[model samples]
Target chain A: MSDNITKGKMIKPENLVYTKSRVMTDNVTSYCPGCGHGTAHRIIAEVIEEMDIQSEIIGVAPVGCSVLMYDFLDLDIQQAAHGRAPAVATAIKRLMPEKFVFTYQDDGDLAAIGTAETIHACNRGENIMIVFINNGIYGMTGGQMAPTTLEGMKSSTSPYGRDVATMGNPLKMTDIVATLPGTYYVTRQSVQKPANVRKTKKAIRKALEYQKLNRGTCFIEIVSNCPSGWKMTPVESNKWMEDTMFPYYPLGDFKVPEED
Target chain B: MERELRLMKGNEAIAEAAIRAGADGYFGYPITPQSEVLEYLTMEKPHERTGMIILQAESEVAAINMVYGGAACGKKVMTSSSSPGISLKQEGITYIAGAELPCLIVNVVRGGPGLGTIQPAQSDYFQATKGGGHGDYKLIVLAPASVQEMADFVELAFDLAFKYRNPAMILSDGAIGQMMEKVWLKPQKERSREFPEWATTGKTPDRERNIITSLNLDPNKQEDFNHKLQAKYREIEKNEVLYEEFQCDDAEYLFVAYGTSARVCQKAIELAREEGIKVGLLRPITLFPFPTVIISRLADQVKGILTVEMSAGQMVEDVRLAVNGKIPVEHWGRMGGIVPTPEEAVENLKSKIIGG
Candidate 1:
């Protein structure tokens, strides 16, 4: 009956209200409990507000959960077709080289359907920021197995768990993106803990700042948890992210160009 | 002001005309009958310090996409290719149309269904007017019948495109694309419109970021978007329809043609005059707006009409619809890379009007 236990609980009324620390508008959050998209969105919004680039920043929203981000962000936003955010962003930034352009994409959007566009944009060293969200499964499409689905992870499509031998190994986009010379900054961060959220915010801020200064492509991959799809409670989902996904997709900077 | 006159091929005229028209960039691929466009751009060095970019793209798709990129930045950009190469550019064309960006595309059409031949043909009439790509869209299709119009309409096409914020296509065939003709070039001193405030130029210290996009998820909002596009098309149709009348003042039989076929029709008009047959030509300069009003008026005076094209009868359908069954509109064409000569056109017109 106390505030602390009920606060983070699913039935808690106060937990429904979003954190005022973020720049999101009064739009209702559609994410479920322990869904990492909310945490990632909050961190990005806070970073934008802190950097004071909200007026000049343009964000490209993907076709997944973040597709409705234009309604939430109080900045200029373009909604790209599924997985075509990179191509859209590439054109936008190329046309207006001085704008701070960035794209927010999910694992399926970035690693699967939009792989060609994503890789080419990075390879071209387009001055833009990319915040990739890897939740290990397609949350919007009813827990379908995704390109980043971890081996032995159970989902609606993979009821017996993902098998590496037959389904292929989980794609590590950060590692693949790090190998491209056009990428000036590449990092992977998780949002499991308060300290990690702070770190992720700092990384997001740094990437945006790099793009603002006309430094080349900057990528930040956030390993998030999806409790409803993971078939676990909010607390268990957070623990699972720390215990399982973090070890495989280790959180840290993979590449950073020399400081100007 | 009169400039130096040169006997140039249609493709070369377009390339030179674009430079003289103050085109800031030319991104194109080399294809048959259209290679002269690229060749002229490369060989004739325009002043380079002002940044006139002319890059031979790896493919037609890349060229049109580059045009899209440059046009998005408020630059005067253009590209040219033959029919086969133009097929590769349709996707980019659709994107450019969806984004509502202003650019110019030149297609020197050849005989087709597929790589049919490099010879002259008007097979691309349907593709030019009926929205080549998926979706309900229309490009301002300019059919240039001679090298003079080839030089003249490049500037006009750019002006109309920028005026309407839509892509404009100068649809020609291999005959007009390759034949030598005299042209007087004039410089395009200023753009028809100032770059809009909403162009995707970078944000200044005081302004918010600008985004160019075609996404509208809300059904009502998308409906409004379609409505606005249709309204723009209506305005363009009212103001941009261009056609030429040749001795149609008191003629009873009229010949309808466009692009290269129109030139042949002109010669046919001269031959029919000698034969004591009152035959006149109605040539459309802008094919999309179709000059339906002219056909409607001509149908009142003329007893019959002959559509002389180099391909299977395409524009004849439009003429038939325009005449509304009042007059008999017949089609005569020679397909698969064959050019219907002036004599053939006159013979068809005589048979249709005199025989009927």
Candidate 2:
């Protein structure tokens, strides 16, 4: 039976394969099962290749699971300290305005520790892209509560569900960022289904395109999943994302500028 | 062609000089008297079709880091602030120095122990010459007296920064930054110097990955890094010592000063000369490679050397070290933004020269 499975074709539960390849390799990701980061990475890599701006692109990796993204992506990568990716990317884009620069940040890194850098970078109208991953919990640091964690979501730190009176409410970063005129593009997308993944790929592509055109600041928030931290299986996590997360954090573009 | 100069403030001169020097970018935060630098840049349309980038950063820390990023890519970048702001930029300054990136940093120094008065002071003399940041490093510190030198030294600072691939500083004071004079701006020249291919401007086919980092984990490798930096310092000291002398031919007393103090000392020397006392001034332009040999030679001919400054005797230490007790070296200064008048400096010089 094992021989039969090997002879024909066997798609493993943990393995993911994409059609188009850019600089990112086909190695199995270090993310846990049902992790949405792998999907987001694949979409960004595909968009980079599609735009054909790989050579002139620079990516800043923030501290978290994505800290070692330099190894995965074959672009000029700079590692920024926790929550400092926006500040670093601001410098890179300002210096080499012709280069397509972006940062991949986690919720804990952006909303919690690096709030000032993110807000100011957007306010300054830095012509760079930000791919913010909001997984509701700190996946790399043993599943701690994050700034974007839902009010009732329990984690290692908040073993008794996230009490808003004590831990504060979930931060709406996309809505906040949309208020800034410097922000040219702001959107929130998910990766629970293939249709949503396709839409997310388009959103990511649009942000990269805006950067290429040197329009202004572009931001995309990905409401990602962490099955390991959520204490659910891969299938159940996907179901939970649709049932629980979508209602609170509706997915769609929050701001799209009209050409004058 | 030599042109007549108009009077201008030192900070205003810096702004005009940066424009005339074809500086590609200016990232600065406003502080005290140095606000004129930012104000001038904002008023001037330097970035219109000239490819110049001017930004007012959120803080001094952000401004210097922005300069580091721009300089890393081979752009002519600069930033200016006062003492407190300069303190916030030490981390980024150390990184730029460690990477051997070329950039200019201007410090319009003010009194400071902790949020001290915004008045003029030379309290940052030790911080400027002796590495302001952590680790082993040195900035080419240029002290300018007149508004002309303030304008002239900006161009010179850029030259030295690019030549040595290190951060260069123009250390001035509030009197120089705020006082107005006439200045004739010179024509800007296109920089033709080529940077090493190792600068992180992205990879060409010929070179390996160019990493601009200060991290060294291994002890042996760190030692080698230190040795290389020392060699660079020695080369700089040999080639970059700059100073000016006034009426030292047959003088009995020598007045050692720099920056704003030098200007006051020059007036004092004239007054002393009228009083039948042969007094001369030796003003150092480059404070880091402190004009040691010149002071040593002057010590042989002079009876005593009086070091005058706006702060409590910082450069006097260097003067004593240079003279090495051969001649009695004395110092007098006013702290907390008070400029020592020519009368005060002349009186102090008279006491040191005659009373001794």
- The whole-model lDDT of each prediction reads 0.83, 0.84
Model 2 Cα lDDT, one tens digit per residue, B120-206: 999999989988998899999999887777898888999899888899999999988998877777776554345456554543335
Local lDDT at A171 for model 2? 94
Under CAPRI classification, how is model 1 graded? incorrect
lDDT of 2: 0.84
Best-matching candidate per TM-score: 2
- When summed lDDT is taken over every stretch of 10 residues in candidate 1 chain A, the lowest stretch is A13-22
lDDT, candidate 1, at A53: 67
Q: Please give each candidate's TM-score.
A: 0.80, 0.81
Candidate 1, residue B266: how far the Cα is off, in Å: 2.0
**DockQ for each model:** 0.19, 0.23
Q: TM for chain B in all models?
A: 0.95, 0.96
